[model samples]
Target: AAMDIRTLTDDLSVTGQITQDQLAQIAAQGFRAIICNRPDGEEPGQPSFAQIEEAARAAGIAARYLPVTGADLTDDKAAAFAGLLNTLPGPVLAYCRSGMRSATLSSLAQANQDHPAA
Candidate 1:
């Protein structure tokens, strides 16, 4: 499936399936990084991890895949996502099936970053 980049916040963009060509286009459009929120092997027809990573590398954009399941939104995941957000240059694009998990993870990461004591 083709990806649709939606701005969730100032620094975050979430999307559904992002193809290698789409990643390249996004890089051309000045996106700095990408995060994959869907778990590897979750769906049969999804793009492989290596394909996305190779595309990001070719496009000179940073990429990270932190697979998340529906019931696996742990604090560790949120913290890890926050860490990635902090490290990415800017305008990070996160993706998953239907983009729901991606958006949820990004939002939770931002919330966690905002509330240090939480």
Candidate 2:
């Protein structure tokens, strides 16, 4: 499948689900890290986070798993996503089932970062 990666910021991009085989291509794209937002077993034939993490490790790319369904995107989850974005080497690529969840999380993270509550 085409990567279909969409850049959300200089440091971050979002994409639909990816397979382990795609790690090399992702690394070649200059991304230093990956975040998997899709949960394991969400769909049949989907690669588990463990599988992706291992592949990423071999490819010399950092990996993080912050799985969430659309309804599970609470403020705390967004905060956690922000933490990952801040600490993970960039540019980072975050992916979920169709990319929408990842994009939504990225936007929430940015908004919270820009306007922290007093």
Candidate 3:
């Protein structure tokens, strides 16, 4: 279930997609949390957020479904994502269909209240 994960910063990384079993591997790799940017039923074989959440819970890693498709990406979602990161354990991994949405969101999260549109 391992995939080539892209580390974006000290505490953030983006991944294409992950399987249920990959949650354990993510924990083993020192990622304390997961943000699923991919929506449920996006693809025929893609695992749902509920399934991944169950695996993450069993692995002792927190997981949240913050799904965002390309068209749905917004500064508000990014800010919310940042808030989630601030509250969750460090070294979080955010995964989307191609990791692009997650990566973009991570960058947007770096913006602040003064420039939420950034």
Worst 10 residues of 2 by lDDT: 109-118
Give the TM-score comparing model 2 with the true structure, all chains together: 0.98
Superposed by TM-score, candidate 2 places the C-alpha of residue 105 at a distance from the truth, in angstroms, of: 0.4
Compare candidates 2 and 3 on lDDT and give the better one.
2
**Candidate 3 regions off by >4 Å?**
113-118
- Error in Å for residue 81 of model 3: 0.8
| Clash count for each candidate, listed in order shown | 0, 0, 0
Instruction: Indicate which candidate wins on lDDT.
Output: 2
lDDT, model 3, position 50:
93
**TM-score winner:** 2
Better of 1 and 2 by TM-score: 2
Instruction: Work out how many backbone clashes candidate 2 has.
Output: 0
lDDT of 1 by residue, 1-118 (tens): 4557799887888888887788778898778999998877777877887899998999999999898988998778988998898898888888887788888887787777778763
lDDT of each: 0.84, 0.95, 0.89
Q: Write model 3 residue lDDT over 1-118, tens digit each, in one string.
A: 4587999989999998899988878889999999999999999999999999999999999999998989988888888899888998889999998899999998888856546443
lDDT of 2 by residue, 1-114 (tens): 998999999999999999999999999999999999999999899999999999999999999999999899877889999999889999999999999999999888888888
Candidate 1 whole-model C-alpha lDDT, 0 to 1? 0.84
Per-candidate Cα RMSD to the true structure, in Å, reads: 1.5, 0.6, 1.9
For model 1, what is the alpha-carbon lDDT of residue 6? 90
